[model samples]
Target: MNEQIHEKLKEIKQSFRLMMNGVASHSMREKWVAYKINWGVPIPDLQKMAAEYGKDYELAIELWKEEIRECQVLATLIMPAEKMDEDLVEVWMERLRTQEMAEMLAFNLLQHLDFAPALAYKWIASDRDMYQLCGYQLLARLFARGMEPNERGINEFLDQAHTTLEGNNLPLKHAAYNCVLSFCELGDEFDVIAQKALADLNIL
Candidate 1:
């Protein structure tokens, strides 16, 4: 049954891949999809697949990220109804240890409200460079979604965000921008927090 599910998913992946044929890599595919397709369309396909599999979110997550951006959109859509349990979240987090794919997975996992902050926090502290970025990205997504961001946690994340900027890649900066963007949208409620974030970080 699982094999059947995977086969069906592969067929879809291949079909989409063909639609973007000559896209040599995931990044190219992302750019093409971002420019050409409406993200909203992928959800119905994802939801249909999710329901067909009886809420096997883990499988859906795995299949979704097999192609990165398309997978990320699908994973985000899959989150509202069927959230993965803690154990499966851990499995997903473990996959984030590999820098090559972790960023996309971490981004997707944060969309699912069931994920524990500890999972994201742990990866933020990890020695692996990109996983650290993934960690920050997850936290940013959570903060952006208004899921977490209590004082102490937000303060801790602020400190990490500062440290992150001192590191490399655009991921950390993007994460901070996303968090502040969310904070700004919350109006005066997050003014003090946003002020603290600006004060503590060199982020532009």
Candidate 2:
């Protein structure tokens, strides 16, 4: 299994070299996106690669262990969400280093977990900005899928969001704003609550 995975990883790395975009890679570096190696493959191309390779748990795990930006994004795309557990999720989250990775993980994998709501709630309360960003992005994904929070959940999410919006992290603010928009999409009930929250923030 290890040998096969290594072989597969070698092939993937070769593919990355073939598809690499120097301009895009430079852009990511200019934006301060740090990774040990960034092949500069765009997400759409990675998506195509993922579809071609299909989901492979071992392969995804191996890809994620690499510090390459494209590898991590591909890991998120090809990993089986159902196979993810809280501990594995935490381990993966700890390795996150950029907003790009956070968004990719949230959109492609995190939101599909059985305990996605729990992950969102737990991460939103963290002092780490990346965790908060991932939390909000995951929340946005869930909400976009028509998930609604209970009264308690609403209060918790709004409380964290209120604090997050008032902070200095522009990326987190954008994520939280999108999350609120998604929650508001649930219906008139959620919309009213979100409006009230926005008004309290003097954002209305």
Clashing pairs in 2: none
Clashes of each: 1, 0
Give me the displacement of residue 10 in model 2, in angstroms: 0.8
* C-alpha lDDT of residue 182 in model 1: 64
lDDT of candidate 1 over 125-171, digit per residue (tens):
77766556667667666766666467776677666666766566665
For all candidates in order, the CA lDDT equals: 0.56, 0.91
Candidate 1 C-alpha error for residue 114, in Å: 2.6
Q: How does model 1 fare in lDDT?
A: 0.56
User: What TM-score should be assigned to candidate 2?
Assistant: 0.96
- The TM-score leader among the candidates is 2
lDDT (10s digit) by residue, model 2, range 61-165: 999999998889999999998898888898898899999899999999998899999989988999988999999999999999999899999999999999999
TM-score of 1: 0.62
Candidate 2: regions farther than 4 A off: none
